[model samples]
Target: MPSPTKETRTLSPLATLPATMQLHPPPSSGTHRTLRRLQSAHSLGAKAAAQPSLISQQRFQAQNQQQRQQFQRLQPIQQKPPSPARRHVSTARSPQRGRANSDAAPVPTTTQLAAMAMTATRRSALSKRSLAADSMSLERLLRDGPPNDDVEGALESARLKILDQGIRSDSDGMSSLRIYVWLILLNAPVLETDTYLSLIHRGPSPAYSKIRNDTFRTLTTDPLFRRRVSEASLIRLLNAVAWTLHDTREDRTREPSIASIASSSRQSLDQLSSRPGTGHSGYGSGQSHPSSPAAKNRARALTLTTEGSETSMAAESGTYVQGMNVLAAPFLYAARSEAEAFIAFHQLLTKELPGYIRGAMDGVHKGLALVDKVLAIVDPRLSLYLLSKNLTAEIYAFPSVLTLCACTPPLPEVLRLWDFLFAYGPHLNILCIVAQLVMIRTKIMDSPSPNKLLRSFPALQADQIKRTTLAIIKMIPDDVYAEIVVHAR
Candidate 1:
């Protein structure tokens, strides 16, 4: 009932609890003590949380002070500024941030390095072989010895020699034995001067007008071809070929039919029977029934027609095609005389490449397709890239296929490429074309418009092309290569 003192008033009601109650507190008092403990813990946690930031600030200040002290110690030492050029060089050598790895060139893998090494070794070996081959002259091989009894064996030996050791020619692509070697490879027989001259005298052939149209443009840009072979000689040679083809066609058409021959034979039999037979019964008598001379002539003509019809039809159809002039240009430039050129050219069209010169030129189309296929097999990435640009071999390889790559420039290199072609197989020219594409693949892939770069191919590099061609050969499948072999047949 007494009034409360200031001290009691200041104390909390819970603090005024009896001593026994304090020792054994009620549930609510326990809750209050727990809340106090929690508050104490929360305060401590807050202080701990703030302590790290304070510690970090102190550490930062310490670091700043140390750096200042170091700067003060080095303040008296002066360094010269780099020159602009030196600074530029240093900056260039240094890898920039975020692009340090990007600027560094990736190291080649083991397989790639091995491939490069093998290529170098192969190139060195080829160089050595070429040197050795150059030492053995094909001319000396012929001049030093009498003609071999076995002509075919001798030709095979010469071809092998050419394959192993390319023909040696002057910078102009002239060699004493080049024409002879070509003749041998082409299997052209010895043609007489009179034979060639007689064809020339036959006057303008059915194809003379066409020949004139093409002759002026043949090798027009090639100074070497122009320097050696005149348009007149090319005209004569082609005209002579045309005449030979025309006569051959005439002979084929003039052959007697089987029915006519049979009728003539029957008439001859009737005449013999009616004229003067010892007996009425022709066969019963001692006389025998022999074949008439007319029948024999007819039979021989029939055999001739049958045997030569396929080749005659094929050759006659292509008496002269547009590209024939370009085809003959190389022969004229190589041959010592027009007659030789005519003979070799005729042989080539009639035998080695009849399908090529044919009106349809099916062989050339086949060759272009094969070029695409072989490229796909050998270098698929490049093949796909070209395909992505809608660049097929047909667009760029027509001239190459039709002319056996004579369409490319540098007459000397064409001559060199031809040597290999004649020695091995002209069909290999498809691979040569693909080889050219492979050589310029980098430029083509980097180009925005690859077609422009392909419109006019780079100048011919005979050695590089030959090497690349040889390398590509191993990568081609046998079936694909077989098609390549006969695509230009």
Candidate 2:
């Protein structure tokens, strides 16, 4: 066979080709189109697999766009930008942003609101206290006559002010007017510097050795007292008081006896009645008129009797006592000068608390007894508990009685308590003592040894003490309260 043209040439079929090996029947047109479609699909899948990140990025962008549209729909409407000419005009009219929305401040939290309220309350209270202190100035009250010339009314007003609004003090707790108020309350007369100096020049008293021994110990622990008052000043004041007391004792001793005066007067009256003209018609008749010699003599005898009783009482009181130092400390601390302190101290010893300094300290003993009695009545359970433990006011309340609670610490609080005591009556100190016992009754009862607990009292709190004292006053019987009043005297 000759080779045919390229398009028409056909090689001779291999002889008897196996049916399995025969050339595949020419593919049908439908099958060929199906195969072409499958090829195109496979090619597209391969392209996507080759660059997956690009496809993923495109899908992610589509999702983000949808989210942005949703978010924009929820946003507040925004104003359009102003025209350039309008903006220029607006800027010229107003340099700063308007504050029309300034009133809509953010709401404060609960704690912030509470803190603001507390600050405002504190300011209001401080203002009220300042005004009250100024209005109740004791110096001003003394300089300007009392309103309506009511001295007692003015004093009451001052006391109420002291109670409601405490006296204003400097940072050191010193009050300029406290001494003056104390002088007025104590009725201490003004003394010349010369008088105090004269007493100082007279050298130490008979009690000087004893006074010296105590001088170093007076308020030894109180920094304020030590800073303000010196040992020499205390010595001078105490020595002056001792001299006054010594002179008083000597004067009392020199006084004529009532019995002698009475006997002498009786003898004179007898002789006068024995006279001829004065016999039956005069003193002997016992019908003498008020102006008659017999009546005058009798009146004089009665006066002597009254004076004798008073003298005997004075004689019982000693010139100096162990606790007088403590008693004088507050006066010294409060006074502006030694002379002032001297006046107050002398007055207190001779007038207000003479009984307390008696040779036996009978008044202190009485005060202690009154404390027990008052406690027994006011709080029977506590009183019974104490009694069972062999605890008596005598054991626990001696210094309190002797010093008028000046033995307590925190001199400022003592000063405040003194204000109340001097204003009302020093006798109320018994009530105050009882009030302290009542205040700690629960603690005392709980303790196994109350004596140890009461050995030294807790620090003074003037307000709480006063309130408790007032409450105790209401509960006590009248007789016991009266005893409390006079026991100190």
Candidate 3:
């Protein structure tokens, strides 16, 4: 039997199996045997699906054991709760310090009361005089107010803290506490999920799906924990994630970040994870393949469609996507693959959409369609977003994920919608985007009309574009969401 050529890899299973298919050749004996074996293995998959190859299982077990050991090693240095004796000891020390803390006596004054009053009055008047000045005047005025040698030190600290916060926001891994809380959270009889244990013990593995799915069943058992992780809170979490993804170039480049709208978030170092071995996980250490049959099918239907990464995103929008490319490149490629899957999902949703949803998300659908065309050359269903309409000229949907939430008005509400989009399927997120557009339709339409300043009103950054998109989506009836819940996503 002749060896199969590279072209064979290009055809899909259904396409290749049919006599009408011409791209792939009839399988040679060796190729035929390979196909038969693949079919046989696939048939046996349901039985062994819960398990894996002995090699993989053993490796997983050993990895799990090592993770347990590492978790043990990582267990935080737990502080013992204060005992009564310790309280007494602290009490005993307080009075002795208090007695010593006071100054012994007052020194005699050198100046008169009138001079002191005059000095104080002059300084007050001078402060008022200085404030009513421009930059240069303010600079000179600041010099007159007080000695500022330590101001340099204070400024340096501020700079350092700012840099640290920036680092924290971008971190996807350990920046501060993740485990200390886990250790305590895990031991509480009614507080934690086995989900906490699995990550700590196994790191991260592709095999965690079953464990996580099982854990999901137990999530409601811990009422307090459930409340802590409510949809509202999860939306807050997504907001954090959106912030974490913040790139200065994208998020705050155009508009000033409204200080009033956003609270300053410092990186929390005092996490429950201050204690070691508390909550970290080893699951997801292994690579993740696409889970659904469609994903697998998509893999076979390979394309050069690059995943939507900051770079590719920037390229599409004519901006330089910041950050290290290596870390982001793989994900971008994955996004391209994700986009392909999204288009296929979009196809399914289009077939199933209720009349209203189909009508409302027209532009969003158009965007998805555009995404499909862009990725069609590579493969469709890469990293497509069914973006809700952004009608305000003040802000269009910001390009990168970092900038997306930053540009929205009802940001907290917005991020909650984004959370499930990424959480479920990568490409299937188009539905959530569409849903949000519908949700915000009225707010957008009521906002001031788009600036007609631009020659092309329907441009990407058009003022009413988002609202128009939303209005379009508003037409989708609730019944359309059934498809979203069951299949679209």
Candidate 4:
């Protein structure tokens, strides 16, 4: 179909018509607007067409002017000749600096470039590996978590049994007495443990001769207990310490079960004393000495004697304080290759899983509040530590409560907490420290500010520590998990 077109009219007098005119009726308002638009567009087209011509003319004028200016300037130079000295000076200076080796010809092979590139690549890789090795080392225990699958299951079972046994209606479980016993046993020398074990087998007694006799026999049977400690070595010698400190035969000399062992040890001690004894640095060079008896007594006194309750333990069962002290140098050394594995574990637990699903997340405001609360009340020492250490986000992301401080303090305190961590891992141990600290806070709150609190905690007992740590782990709600960014690691 053909398109429709309306008639056109102009406001000019010739375009206008008399009142009776009909051949082309006057245009409507719509047609007038269309004509006005067309007229304006035509005018715009003319202006656009004129711009290029103007520009071309300007260029032509510019070209002519530039040629004239160049001709005028070059006339003087053309009239003169270059000096010989100036030519020589230019040639000599430019060529000397630009030449390669002054004798060798140019032209590098593609193969040579490829070989050079390969060498550069290899050097870069080697440098990267070296830097990685130095900045961060491999610590397997921290990286790998507990190796024993059985240990993991055992800990869970132990947790259940403890919770069932000790938890009151309103609360979670108390600390496991068995673990407390075990930790103390772990810390004490094995020889002493054996002696004490034997003594405990017998009824309690204070008989000097009888006790000495029992202690002597126990040491003979337990040949593993006599090894010396390596001061320079990095890993924990738990079994070694357990073997040495646990020689308690003297504690129960009269008891029937290990009575003979004590009698033998005592007899041996007396014989050595009577002989004026000898000194031994274990590499076996020593001379019989006059003061041997007194020295031997002092040596014997050093053994850990857990007699009556197996209950007498170190004053402190460290959680954050000790971990806060040592952070985790010993365990990472012991479990040298697995440190990153723990960091990864923390990253997952504390980061990926949002707590909102659990309906406990209080959004950003509430989340920040809880974080502040934990930092403020959980351990005042942590703030001082955070301030002093200038903890980075990477550090706070550390899932373990101890983070860097676990191994910071004295040997005894660090080991006690480590025994718990090695036995338990981050989940229970870190949580319980918080819960336990909260429980005992009233007692120790006023003694020191955050910095001084560091000193007060190392003296805590094993049992008290266990109970409180468990409570915290069992009670922390799923909601707040979002706040702990370290868990994702």
Candidate 5:
């Protein structure tokens, strides 16, 4: 007991303690294994918690990417309407990297692709005289008797025949007869080359500035128009017409004796504008509008001569507007010479549809309104839907009405439509406008933004428009048709 060793003393104390209270260390291998198991379990729990969030984040990114891609697909390219020379461009989908999965849906065919492929029957030129010969035939029929004879019966017969068979086909080349046919329908007097030559020699027109600005841009996208038509020719033709109008007005103002003629003409103008039947009953219908009213008024009232004058008459008829160049393009394309084109274009503005190109373009505005009215009549449901979205004719049909639907592409189709217009009545254009709305009524009603559909109307299906137009015409009342006659003039 005296001064016992430390080990012995510690052993003596543990012997006094209960065996259960004693401490002992486990084997190193066992302790390490237990710690490893705990660490593995904790890590497994952490991974399980993070997996859901990671998967959700990836799914959201994929969804966002898909929406972006869909938006890109829906965005339309900024382009003029489709042209005849432009063939169908395939929209077949190429396999995208992330999107090519087993769950992805297959691509579907579009109605538009089918429509684009279905072009109207194109006419071939049998000979250069085909169009002119047809015109001559029509002339003989109309002039079968005296000039003052009741040619209405004969005129109606000829129109029906031409409408059934469009002014010669434009199969491979331009139809030489289209110009003559257009001139005949317009009742424009035949002119010698000297008339146009004289006008050109007179130098720049009072509207030269506006004409020059628009000439280069006319139908720039159409291959035929761009390649075949020279800017110089268009400028010259428009300038000459402007000069003729200016010269005529200046000549009229200078002669006091013509004052009485002018007064009577103005009175007649007031009457024609107010009374539909008294005016030209058919626009582009091959029937002549009395010259005393339209011609005299244009000459006397629209004194838009030299230097863009601000007089009411000058403002009404003075400088060129935005779409005149486009309006003149079809004329130049069909005419053999500037003289022929000049006569047609001049008569169109002054006699055929004076209100269209006037300073205010009131006739164009009226045409737009009539388009809306006609649509509402033909398809009330579609019209109401469009009206609800504020998509009126002015927003979409302005160019079509202003250019007689020539503003849109597939030049061949436009030429065909013009054939119908010339043979029947440009007033039929209103019916044509209604037909357009009817053709795609479903798509328009389904669209969230119909303006996009209207901004540039769907490509011209000449046959479809003509067929639909003819059917619509039969349904229209005589009174409404009369209103359409005067709507643009």
Candidate 6:
């Protein structure tokens, strides 16, 4: 009920702490400095609290004045109109030295405007070219129909069409034309379904397990390949080819050949003539039978050598290899039917690229050496750089050679390249392998670690490769190209 005392009213919040709190000694210099700042802040806060409206208005006016200054600086300066020549000269003089002022409006120079126009025009031209290219239809190539006698011209025309305009990809519903063009290029005649079915009916091949192992994994990452071609279908086709190869080998082995017999007899005679006391010894000497271990060992060795030659012949004829699935995948993907795929694949293996799937894979090795030789000829600097680092083509290009460059990603691009190779000659694949190195020569040379770069080559840009491959054919000497022919054989 009574009025408050003056002493009580003057007591501050800090004053309410117990005297025990102040019993500590005066704070250290750092603590004392912090205390002074706190005291100053407290006094300023109290003063601001006394006239909050005035403080807010002052802040608002300060913000407006700053904004007005910014706005004034942002306004563009107008100058007397100058002659066109002076305008361009003035723009050309401005080199854009450094970071622009934050307050000033950006003023593009006449040179910048010209550059922008040029870039826009370039973009428009590129777009038009692309549109023109897309406008070419598969029907156009087919409408001309295939030539009967002039095979080279027909092939040349088809290749030109493919280069100018990509094939109708499987994504498009018009792959029938693509298949037809491929058939023509491959020189693969359309096979009857009955023949293919009969091959399949021969049952699973000795290579069936190998085919199944590879079939599912073929282009597993390729959506187009996976979406269109089923693994089961691929397995069936490979198995049928295996049976055909097996049957053919069996037929050849069962049939007697005079050449084989004569060569074998000549080899035995040569062996007998080579050994001491061994010339027609059965006529007078005691040894007619292979009774001694030494004689028995010699006889066994001859048998093995004969068997080895026969095995090698059969393998070179048609036995499947590890990478054959990848080699055949592009064909199967492009071909509409299993029979077409089988015939194309068979032709590719037996005729086009026989050495690739052979027991020794001699073609792959030769191709690797050819890659080195071709690269040395085309891009001598990059080739030497790689060789200096011991990064031979055998280390990096084995897959490329074996698969005929189909192992590269973006299956669509690979297919386009094949159209070119098949139309001309699958032999051109060696040139293509060289083309990839040419495209990325700069990157490889610049990198400190060339092995890392060579470990995985860049993705295929088929158009670029097709052009480069063509260019390489001209760049390389005829002798080198001849070597390319002999390398794969």
Q: Evaluated with TM-score, which candidate comes out highest?
A: 2
Query: Which residues of candidate 3, in runs, are more than 4 Å off?
Result: 1-395, 398-415, 443-448, 451-489
Candidate 2 contains a number of clashing pairs equal to 0
Better of 1 and 6 by TM-score: 1
lDDT (Cα) of model 2? 0.57
- Which is superior by lDDT, 2 or 6? 2
Across residues 1-489, which tens digit of lDDT does each residue of candidate 5 receive? 011111111111112212332112223544444443333333332234433233343343354445435433432222222222222222222333332233222221234223322211000001111222334455454334212332333343344445555566556338766776666566555465665676678787768876776677778778887777899999998887776566555554422222233344343112211110100111121111223365345334323334446644545455455567777888888778877777778867776677776655677767777777878777788889988986777566756776788777777788888776765556667778888788788889899998776666677877777766654543455457567877766
lDDT of 3 by residue, 159-256 (tens): 12221121121112221221211111111111122322322343323212222332232223323333333433222222221222232224543222
Whole-model lDDT per candidate? 0.57, 0.57, 0.24, 0.28, 0.55, 0.55
Per-residue C-alpha lDDT of model 1 across residues 257-371, encoded as one tens digit per residue: 2223334434311221110000110011111111446423422321221222345453234566666777788888888999778877886776667667654566766887888
Runs with alpha carbons beyond 4 Å of true place in candidate 4: 1-155, 158-231, 235-372, 375-405, 408-424, 427-433, 443-450, 482-488
Could you tell which candidate, 1 or 2, scores higher by TM-score? 2
Better of 4 and 6 by lDDT: 6
Q: What TM-score should be assigned to candidate 1?
A: 0.58
The regions of model 5 sitting more than 4 angstroms off are: 1-154, 248-315
What TM-score, over all chains together, does every model reach?
0.58, 0.59, 0.18, 0.25, 0.59, 0.58
True-structure lDDT of candidate 3: 0.24
Misplaced by over 4 Å in model 1 are 1-136, 144-156, 253-316
lDDT per residue for candidate 4 within 1-489, as digits (tens), equals: 000000000101122222332122223545434433433332333234433333333344354445435434422112111122111010011112222232222222345334434333322221111222222212221133223423222222232222223212111111223223222112211122354344333433322222332222211211222221222121122221122223332242233332243344443112211100001111111112213574244223322233343443332110111111123233323222222212222121222222211111212123333433444444566434444543321223121232312322233333344444333332333443444344444544454443234322333343445544433332233334323322312
38 Cα displacement, candidate 2 (Å): 99
In terms of TM-score, how similar is model 6 to the real structure? 0.58
Per-candidate count of clashing residue pairs (backbone under 3 Å): 0, 0, 59, 81, 3, 0
Error of 4 at 166 (Å): 14
lDDT of 2 by residue, 389-456 (tens): 87887667767877888877778888888876765557778878887887787799999999888777
